[model samples]
Target: MPATPAWPPKSAPRLFVADVLSAGLAVRIEGNPAHYLARVMRVAPGDVVILCDDVTGEWAARVSDVGKRDVVVEIAELLRPREAVPDLWLCPALLKKDRFDLILEKATELGTARIQPLITRRCVADKLNLERARAITTEAAEQCARTALPELNEPVKLDALLAGWPEDRALFFADENGGEPAAQAFAASKGSPAAILTGPEGGFDDAERAAIRAHPQARPITLGPRILRGETAAIAALAAWMAISGDW
Candidate 1:
């Protein structure tokens, strides 16, 4: 006989729901998500739909009802528990709208525990739409099949962020002027709670840089010899840290 098909087939349409999923729970997906499932994916009764609640975990659900503006799925069984992401945060100075959006999407895909946007003297953009930002992260998480979403915090001024910095978490500053190599620094602080801070377009002003360096938990690190753009630095630093110290 042929081998049995896998439960929650890989081709199933995955979605992150707002409800706390449980066995036999009926989930009603509405609005945009409903349109994607009902019209885009054209899911019908008995079709398999993968759901994640962020709080609980991943689950296998079967479509029980379909409507013009909604689709209901009955949770079948839990596939896996919410993943344990690294205790790493990405604190990047606000860049342009499109650039910062990239940072948010890539950070979520790379498994950042939290994203703390910073407002520095050199920052071109100081405001972030939390709702839209959260949407970007949520979409990225779904595309990457991540069970848990990254904590997206509102943009805070650089000084305020430094003042309220946690005592235990190490803050790795991506200083363009130069400092310790990123790989070496990350390796040394492996298995510790850490956060990487990258500057904005023109980089941090002199006073801001000095203040950051003066922080007790701050460790200035260099990406390489060449200077990187705001978005590039954040993404590069995160990728390198994940490869070296993260759960990769």
Candidate 2:
């Protein structure tokens, strides 16, 4: 006899649904997601589609019908609970649009609990479309099979961020000028709430660096000897921190 087909086959298309999914509930997917399912994936009745609500985690659903403007699915069972994300925030100075977009994507995939965009004097870009940023993060999370979404905050001035800094959280400042080794610093602060602050493409200026250093919670740490671009530094530092403090 042929081997049994896998339940909720690995080839199933996955999606993040807005509604809280439970067993036996029918959900109609509309708008862009509906279009993608109908046109791009060509999902048909009986096809398995993995759904996540960000709250209830992953669910296996079977497409019940396909209409011109919508695709309906019935939630069959809960597959996996939402993932536990580390209490790590990524606070990076804004880079160009394309570069910052990359940071948002990777940060979400890497399990960043939150993302705080900083606007500094040297920042190449100051404005960020919150909707677009969320979209980028959501897409990344879906692609990476993340059950939780990272909180994306509005872009704030460096000074404002410093002023509103939480006391309990340690701020791991990735200072290009130098300080402690990143991995060691992260390991030392393991089990505490932490945020990684990286500079813009132009890097932090003298005054900004001094202000950040003066912050009580800021602990400056160097990434490495070679200078890294703003986006590269953000991702590299987060990856290192994840290896040290996250679910790695």
Candidate 3:
């Protein structure tokens, strides 16, 4: 028996969006990510890689040309179909760029159905660029070999979020203030669509917390005894739910 080649290969294949990927497919490297893959990682022709368009699932690709200024890869074949993501959404308050970026990447790898960036009163960054966030998650998905990209929604205010929230789906909110243990809440939510809500850096104001708690579908869940950073709380909470009530 021989060792099978890695699904993504160890060559650090990059993703691209172009029609018709086959042997001898030519791809142009642009943007910082492409530059980094070409220059930093030192990818060369004949190196196996991965490519995906938000349209189809991931494909197996290989570098056809190692340009001095740009790197081009040819798509070989379709490796896998679009992945089946969970039916859960992560509604997390906006954190600093790096933290939010990490959350998007990790959440994509963990297979969250959707990511809604919430704008609460205490949120440090009021505005979030949807394009950048999508890119972050897209690259992460491609790297993680995910077939489907998680929907990255525009930033919505906390009040508006609570008012227009879907009533049928259960909402598990982290009450930096106090609430039921996460495991218990998630166990009770088995077989139901749910969303995890985490507050911003400064946490939620009293009125904001009250509003979330007032919702009939809302249930406050605890991370633990100690406090968690806004981003950390969101990721940990969702991971717990995925294990308990989701497809983990």
Best by lDDT: 1
RMSD of each: 1.0, 1.0, 3.2
Clashing pairs in 1: none
What lDDT, from 0 to 1, does candidate 1 have?
0.96
Q: Which residue segments of model 2 deviate by more than 4 Å?
A: none
TM-score of 1: 0.97
* lDDT of candidates 1 onward, in order: 0.96, 0.94, 0.82
Q: Which digits, one per residue and each the tens of the lDDT, describe model 2 over residues 152-211?
A: 999999999999999999999999999999999999999999999999989999999999
Please write out the lDDT profile of model 1 over residues 80-182, one tens digit for every residue. 9999999999999999999999999999999999999999998998799999999999999999999999999999998899999999999999999999999
Per-candidate TM-scores read 0.97, 0.97, 0.83
Arrange candidates by TM-score, descending.
1, 2, 3
Model 1 error, position 10 (Å): 2.1
